[model samples]
Target: MAVDDFNRADSNDLGVNWTESDYSTPNSLRILNNRLRMGEANGIAHYNGTFADDQYVEATVTGMQFGDGQTGIAVRVSGSQGGFSAYAAILWPVSGRVRLYKYVSAWIVADAQVELANVPYTLLTDGVLQFSTVKIAAIGATIKVYIDSVEVISVSDNSIASGNPGLIARSSYWVELDDWTGQSLSYDITADAVTNGSITPAGVTSVVGGGSQMYAITPDSGYGIFDVLIDSVSVGAVSSYNFTNVAEAHTISATFGPLMGQRALLKIRPENCGHITINDNSPQYWFQHGDNIVIEPVPDAVYALKLYVSDFPDAALTTGEPDSLPDEFHSCIVDFACYALSMKLKKWKQAAKYYNIYVKNLTQRRKDYIDRKAEKRAIHQIPNNIKYGGTRQ
Candidate 1:
């Protein structure tokens, strides 16, 4: 996407992304109040990037300095200054006429009147600042002209093969231009996935000018990818797929199925611990589903399990639920809650009192509960499944 809102400091130069040509002496093109203002007639400003052959340039004409002159957007612009090849969609506000013109070399003679809306020249100056919007699209041999989003002209012309898009003014100045945007034609790709599975970026995505994109396939726990399809044709059970240099729209989907195996999910767990050992042995393969653990080659015997964790609740405490903190230090939680409530109610004095009490109780709780632990450094092992999200990437 190429867009220039002209929101820049006032200057004769339009920065590095624009090339300017003055047909007349001292052609002044400056950015003022986030709009492009022209000071001389017959001057053109072209965007610096090369655009595809099939592209469109559009701009909202907020102000027209002279209704008798013509101003519009040009596409497939080649050459520079005096001589250039471009298809221009010109608009004449005074006569309410819009025209399509093909410019070649130093002479711009060919003109085809596309539409005449019979709009008065005084209507633009009668307190209204914005009048018309001009847009031109060149695709293949077809050149289209649009006035205020209404297609008025569709002609076949292939004189210009490829170039940049730009803004041009003829016998016009101080033509305020805003929301100038240009882009190559783009196509859409729709991606979908069935239940128990997902395709990354699963939606309608727009790609331009033979762009490429990649999609990742993922299945829910205890499920395996069954099949993958592109454009309704099966592409096998691939974990990922890529669309290289995409030229047209496409569709992609994936299906999944439950894995065939004896499985068990252990729900009971200590807070803030991941590693697990059964019968003093670490299971070689296991994955976590939510808070539960799923171990492969399910353990057959009743075994003792050990893990490291604090007694505190794994998640925030909800209303009507008892906290995991010891009963002796329960007042600390109450004090903190009171402090938060007081702060919400904007009672600073009450909030300060509760906060001080919370700090005092917290200090006592730390001394009673935390001091019992011996000063020692221990390394906690991370589960292999969690280390790589249950996949050996």
Candidate 2:
């Protein structure tokens, strides 16, 4: 849904150099590639690869030079009917201060120009060495700008209703139209190495006994620490990143951590040296139960993974003699049992665990009644209103 925040760089994704133009009048207007380097008055650009009226446009430019007539990315771009703008400008003399400007159709829209002067290096140098990333995503009637991962401003209007994207070099200017970072990095997972991954709703489970009844999250197939934990407590704190069986994919295993007799929330963050950035800035999300989370790079790559769990809490029946048939006092089945039912209804997995004690008991009672009647008939027989007896001497 929205790339889950983290943007990973992969092979098959969009890139800067990403374009629009009029081929008939190549000189009148041109798109050298996927970029719009416009000249003349109020030249506009659009990056709607989908050509859709509403969408987000983000770009990353490195090595930008200061002291130019005008240099910035445009947004809320549409046709001659309606449009809007959310751009970052290197307004001469105002170097490090990020400024915002907006317009609706032909009307100027104002939001008390805001500036972010914190990251000084964010400024552009003498018509060179200026690097800045811009992003504009449509959120309702407004288009917002995020300069290098930071939200700067949002503008709302209905001018130039829809059109192509334009990276205007308004007035006298010279700038390196480089790759847009937002679209530059994109890739997908060709192979996954996570082996044996499971989660417990109530708590982790242990394969070994005589050790504090701790629960766990483990990658049973791999030989790494498989760093285990619940909530923030450390279950099995492995000190390395490369989890490999060297023979097959790695499996991470987790045993209950130092909970001191309490259930903890399970959180998983990948740390494989080549697999995870360790300090990945990408977005993260919680598990289906909102406990275990799977994170990936954002706006670039997507990965498909399934959560395979063993002891589903609701499906767990009491560990004792087979429960009495057709239990009356307790209408509710064991916790795991309920969960298994839910999974079945949703068609989530394939398991042989479909047992209804109520039905089994009913069948057994019916059979018992028939057996008693047959035994009595073998000893004696009754014919309608009369009794049948053995023949007399």
Candidate 3:
């Protein structure tokens, strides 16, 4: 067995991409099942050969950001080859948050959520984390996952719809996970939220109350909407909105003008009440604790530009005069915000007769913000990859 199987000597981060060998870093050497004589990792360890079919791969990686770069072992993964759709090994530093992402066709989120043990800072004897394990169970359209010898999830959607499989890794960076088990698949519901009476993984809400209940489905793809009836009565009928029933991560926005008279597009989302630094970027509206942000690539809109918060949480969640710092005392507002959105989006009927789920719990202030933000842009159209101090590394 090749001790330097990853071929550390030829790995470097050219900013554009990493070499082929570095693409196959591992989370642990035990993945070899004592088959290979593995040693310390220099970070980059990729499968430098051609592609294959139905392969099981695993690895243990160390010294990587909580959510950056493919720091784990990869098997029969596919990328630029087809827009990065593989099971990356991510070990949350200091907390050992071991996880495997089946980045299917959607490059943003993993096929399903896999929670390993919390990674600790001590694993880095010298920026090298202790051996971790990542495994895969691929079965056509559906992909199952396992970590540390434990099965996690059996996704219902394609992990990465259509593409060849191979290893993946960022340039220069270092992360390793080993367990060269074939590959995995996940027939997961892409990040797109589908709540037209269906409880999907997007920001959801469920409210139940007296009389009849109403709901406003703010999808990641839509503007043309209609009034919703629970039993049968008039509740919230403002605009005839149009939305594409696909998959994607969505926010709370009001689409009023897409129908008839005075059509206006209004949006309401959370912003950080602190500095714009990395430290303050937590509690991002898009993702909740423990893999709540189940994002997906939704279909494009017709005759309209699909509005979305691209650099959100990263850019949207910021603190200023209106934003307040996070505290147990003031945490109720945050919970309220999440609950309000979820309930509104959920199949909940938690209001008096004839109340739209979108309007529940929202005070006058929330309404005002939604009204004002109607003209804001929600995408990151950066020309070229711009690099700052702490970019997407």
Candidate 4:
């Protein structure tokens, strides 16, 4: 029930719906001795309907009069007569190679050939009447080619999902095709995701045995893929996955988690001239640089400094921009500037007040960060109280 025969009374009466296109000349296809003969042109003869996802198309090359060209079976043919696309499993008798090619937009584009095999099959011996059976099987994203019932090439691609089946011949050649047939099978696909992310085509999809489907995972803001699981086995942190030649149902899931301790720029301005310290440690300080002030942490000072502290050594009363601090704590920059200005003016009482405010705001900022992290962990079902050293409780 899976095979369809192509040999009938004539080319038009081949018992299956079919259409042909001559890339070089018109009326290049004819029926001779109950076989489809392609005459001196590069073109394709496409079946006028779609095939199952998991299917195979095969034909026997009965006569190839020229050794310079190639002929083969075309599968998953899509588009119009002038510009169509399909995967071709071809035999080049001159080169003694069996190759898989993708025909697109009225041209046989180069380098798109998926190599299959190389064998001397006497396809162009002129009067020798040698023949070879070429078969192409599409199982999900996997494409496999067989010559004379022996597996030749197998490759994975999700490009052409399902399309019509056909025959193709290239350039100044006479090739005879007979005993063309096609068959189909069945399969299933499924998708899922863990917290903070979603998967496209988010449910089960039914397809033929050789068909393919592409799935993409999108993580929410501040989240990234932790891992991807296919049938309970890890496949690393990939955002996209393609299922091919699925013979049975499958479950694909992606897990996402918050990206830990993301940092942003924080600009700090010092108010007076004095040696400055951050979290009780001195930082690299600069006086002036093109109408701007720059202060950088000493090497390895980032780990020693407090998460919310943004102090730098005193240099000029102008603004100083520090790099790589969390964005949420940016408001504390003004408080620190005021505290430094108060200290420079020798206003001890005012300096103490602003410093206290800066400490309070910094503490609140840290608390907010921790609270947000705890909420994210709850949403992702991760344990919130897992102990850690330093400022990350």
Q: Residues 250-354, candidate 4: write the lDDT tens digits.
A: 888998765444221223222311222334555533322111222322211232223222222231233333344468766776776676554333234575566
Give each model a TM-score.
0.49, 0.32, 0.28, 0.44
**Per-residue CA lDDT of candidate 2, range 1-393, in tens?**
011111334311223432322212222222333443333333434454433334444555533334434455554443431233333333322355444444344311123223322233345445454445666554335555666777766565443344334443344443334443222111111112234444322222222111122233333432222245323344333322232112111223343222122221223221110011113333322222223322222211222321211112222112342223234313323422443332222222211122223223322332343346543111110111111111101
Model 3 lDDT per residue over 1-393, tens place: 111233332223212222332213432122232222122222223344332233345554423543333344444355433244555444344444545555543333233323322333233445455545655544444444455577654554444433333344433333443323332221122221234222122344321111111233442323223333222332342222222321222233332212223121212322211111122234333321121122221222111111112222343523332333223213334434443332232212331111221212222233334445653322211011111111112
- Estimate the TM-score for candidate 3: 0.28
lDDT of 1 by residue, 281-303 (tens): 74522323235455443212233
The alpha-carbon lDDT assigned to residue 5 of candidate 2 equals: 18
Backbone clashes in candidate 4 total: 11
Runs with alpha carbons beyond 4 Å of true place in candidate 1: 7-11, 24-34, 50-53, 104-132, 139-142, 172-174, 195-202, 212-250, 254-393
- In candidate 4, stretches whose alpha carbon ends up further than 4 angstroms from where it belongs are 1-16, 108-131, 186-207, 210-393
Count of clashes, each model: 0, 64, 93, 11
lDDT of 2 at 258: 22
Q: How does candidate 4 score on lDDT?
A: 0.59
Query: CA lDDT, every prediction?
Result: 0.62, 0.33, 0.33, 0.59
Better of 1 and 4 by lDDT: 1
Q: Which candidate number has the best TM-score? A: 1
Model 4 residue 283 CA deviation in Å: 76
